[model samples]
Target: MRSGVSRRTFLASAAAGAGALAGLLPRPLRAQDKTVKIGFLAPLTGPVAAWGKPGLDGCQIWAEWINAGGGINIGGEPHRVEFVAYDDEDDPAKARTGATQLIRENDVKFVMMLGGNSWPGVQPVAERTGMLFSTLLPSDLSPSTATLIAPAEVHPIYNVTAVDWLAANRPELKTAVICAQDDALGLPSVATYLAAFEAAGIEMLDEPLLFDPATTDFAPVVTRMLSKKPQIVCLDTCYSDYVHPICEQLFQQGFKGQILSCTLDFYDQVIAKTSAEFMEGTLFQFPDFDDPALNADFINFQKPNEFFAEYNRRHPGQWGAVSWEYASVMDLWKAAVEKAGSAEPDAVKAAMTEGGEGLHAFGKARWWGKDLFGIDNALVGNWPVVAIEGGKARIKEFRSIPDWYDKHGELMKKHMAAYNQMWDQRG
Candidate 1:
């Protein structure tokens, strides 16, 4: 990747530019005196808050940018964007209630979700109301859920790209062991990692060490995983809550090998807890937006470096995997609403998937996943394989998730079925 401007320099320039623009135009431009509400329903105050709260923070930034820029144009009119947020705490009952309130009371046109434990509760609401919903987890998609779409962040499936990169670059680290908190998020990820490892010709030292989500002490879990002496320790889609303690355990125990995970959210904290040298070369699927690679031509995010700088300035030490994901979904939704000339959920959904393709964060992607998800709802494309170099998360490469599936999809399906994670099995 080409070297980019420093964050401090970039932010300084951005601030100057904004100040210059403000003099030329009215602040908080409202072009048409209209407003559109979007719903952010997810776990914002529990163990999963890392994913939910940071994403909402990013959405606030997105809304400010859009509203200040004269809002989204639908046909010939501009509509200021507003987000209605609800904290589900990853609880099903709360999620159901929150979804209803967002749709019925708040009159939100679109709802975005983290989509794991809370998805079941919102699925029925979507079906009943015909309200379009977006999920980070395409694993939540099925034939019965016509209103739900996975427009961004195809989780677990994207985990395969990191393993693929590892197997090619770190071939010496062959044997691996995996572990995850046994939950909606962890089970599917465990299966995906198993499939990815198998396809890479890496032997799993043992079956995935599933643990209770309630378990706080990770010392024993890390000890059992390290007992086999595997070169790679895979932390399957564990929440940031679980990943932090487990990584600390790995560092304390002094196992020098490759570390892989679906996400290394708040990794700076991890490095601080351990050591910069200890976290070096660790691989995962999400990159810090300030990574120079995000400035590449094909990347669909808007001014990622600026966004990253602004996010840090406003909410320091809070950026995580989902920080930009919800904003990314809003980008797609805005484009679709403009294309369809309406903010109606069905119209926007149809327009978003009009050509069976979408502009994913990394690049252009296909509306795939019928064979696996029982619906062509997921926008699958290249996903970044991130590694910690010099104590900073950087994008190593963008690996094609669909390409890997084309070659080893059956193996993945087999593993998903074994874990009862396949769409049919889920129902």
Candidate 2:
């Protein structure tokens, strides 16, 4: 909002919080030597920690960048950002404790979560305090939540883009199989893939495969999928920790077929377990940060090009679901804070949903998803269909999600009903 702060420049600098962010508090709001703090509530010690910690590191980079650039200008005064962190460990009870700790003890204004089960626990605390809460999981959105947003992703909705691409490109694959953990994120993905695969005209050769995270042997799981003889297999919202073992078994069984997933993080490990040839042609939603299409079409990142170079440099082979996602949310937050000229949660929420096109981490997009999620919190736009070629992953196209929603609205609702996870019940 200030002459010195370009939207692009502000987003880029505030994305990673590379500095301590302790010096970025608004001078007027500063209580003596104290600083402004934002809370990063994530699973830092559970099975999901790998997903949470990397994004926090990115947030650290963003805070540092903003603070270094003379901080954010609010009403002609400068404010630095300080990130206060708490580990929810992907558990409900711990998340509530962390939420209270950050709000009551630390007095943070904004709270970011890796979301999922952890979100349910912290939602009340966020509402009571009127603090801005961000979740990478759009399933966390609802009318009841006046302060929550899924600024970066609509995980399963984007996964449909891959299925759409595959349906048009690989018509020979007429049937498929699916496997997913029986959790919050997993259930919706199962419903989504069922709708996607069906809309693609791919028949299900077998019933959906459900795996327990505690289960150690995936050879049996792969054996079951092989028995169905599906031309394709869907890894519906699986954890990275599970993807390797499942893909390993798929390789050991030598089942060559089309594969789809919501993510393929640390897929290099998957390539090693399988062969480069076997891993090739796999489809997913996420993309490599350096994808050329992003540079040409998007203005959502701090510096998409430079950020990619630095991220890969600092933490090689580790980008996944929440890697740049949380930081991207921070960028949107900065824009909204500027638009509203305040950090109040209600003001930010109203600004986000004022009904025009909004800028998300992925280029400029429309704020949509009320029909699907019971709230318009997801930033809908062109999502990449990433595929593995000769073991190297690359984006093949940026497909429009709006068109697909137009065609398959009823089918998706049916799938959601089957899973008892209509947007109203996402919590």
Candidate 3:
């Protein structure tokens, strides 16, 4: 693996070459041939790499597409986009180091993070540097983190849409068992599922089974969850590493039930381990961009079908929940930079939330989260409910997350408090 300095040097060289080529064009066309760097500070080589590495890949495509046309227009000048990535390995101390380096050395205008345990490490740096940052997890938001935003992928909050869809469509499955690794990512999702199940009137078969992250064997865990004879099994945001083996155990134990989760990343591998028949009808929150639903008139993402095909061509069989999230953030950031007529963090952020709403990947969503995160920084709106059928993932429906919150917001707060997951409690 290349050192951080080496990677930066390579990217700088590539950016210089691109700029040189631009300079060859007519003088009027090369009005302002400059480069803007964005920071990808996340776990690129760890248990969480599934979420981070794929996102950087997608951002690469996004930058190529934008630069091929005309780069982001700021103050009537075009600036090429480049990415500088630093792997935090999901460690807080490493995250802090990465954030400082990306800001002071790389001079990134924006930074995107997976943002669970890593947020704390980056928060202080953001406070000090005033650099704009975006997180996939809205649970990381707080009133003090003014420069931080949840422009895409609301994480546990969006999990409610899946439960809502399940209860309305398959009401027969009234009882559920939930299991998750007890950690920053898992606990909040467990609370969200609890609130969602409660709102939908589905009974939790047992106290959520919180297991240690290091536990390699899942037989005993699955045995305990199955002891209650639940008609539904909810895997509350476990890492793909854990989700896959637990699924294999469910199949080995000969259990047939409706399986729900926050993600089914790399589900094809799970199907291979078990069987396609055994993996059918599993419900999760993310959709493959190739899904026709993304082409709806209200959807804001550009060229979803082509993006999916290009992504698969470049990185075969590596798509996951975050494959497009960071790229999606870039889409919003580019628009904001253009709208504000500058790439400065403060100006771009002001433009992003100027009207109290933003263009989410699904549609226009309100800038909300004050009641939950003690800050109105998360872009809340509709989220998709997906199911695996006939060996492929399909978007079953796009459900309103804001509508669900309006109906059960208090219930969600109660559950979040119970699990010490509310913003205040976390602080």
Clashing pairs in 3: none
Give the top-scoring candidate (lDDT): 3
- TM-scores for all predictions: 0.91, 0.90, 0.91
lDDT of 1: 0.82
- List all candidate RMSDs to the true structure: 5.7, 6.9, 5.4
lDDT of 3 at 200: 94
Clashing pairs counted in every model:
0, 20, 0
Clashing pairs in 1: none
Give the per-residue lDDT of model 3 (tens digit) for 1-427. 2111111110111111122122222334254589889999977786566556656666666676667666777887878788899999889899999999999999999998878888998899999999999987899999888999999879889999999999999989899999999999899899999999999999998999999987888999999999999999999998777788889999999889989988887788889989989889999988888899989999887777776776667556766666666666777898899899999999999999998999988998999999999999999999999999988999999999989999999999999999999998885
Could you give candidate 1's per-residue lDDT for residues 93-189 as a string of tens digits? Answer: 8999999999999999999887888998888888899999988788999999888999877988999998999888888878999999888888989
Off by over 4 Å in 3: 1-32
User: Is candidate 1 or 2 superior in lDDT?
Assistant: 1
Evaluate candidate 2 by giving its C-alpha RMSD to the native, one decimal. Answer: 6.9
Candidate 2 residue spans exceeding 4 A from truth: 1-34
Expressed as tens digits, the lDDT of each residue in 1-427 for candidate 2 is 1111111111122244223223444233443333457898987665666656656666778877766655665455567778898989888789999989998898887888878888888878877877778877787777777677777777777878899999888888898999988888798889888888889998998889888766767889889988988899888888766677788888888888887878887788788767889988998887766667667746566455566667667665555544666666776776677677776678777777678568766677888888987777778887888998878778898888878989998888899888877767654
Per-residue lDDT value at 165 in model 2: 93
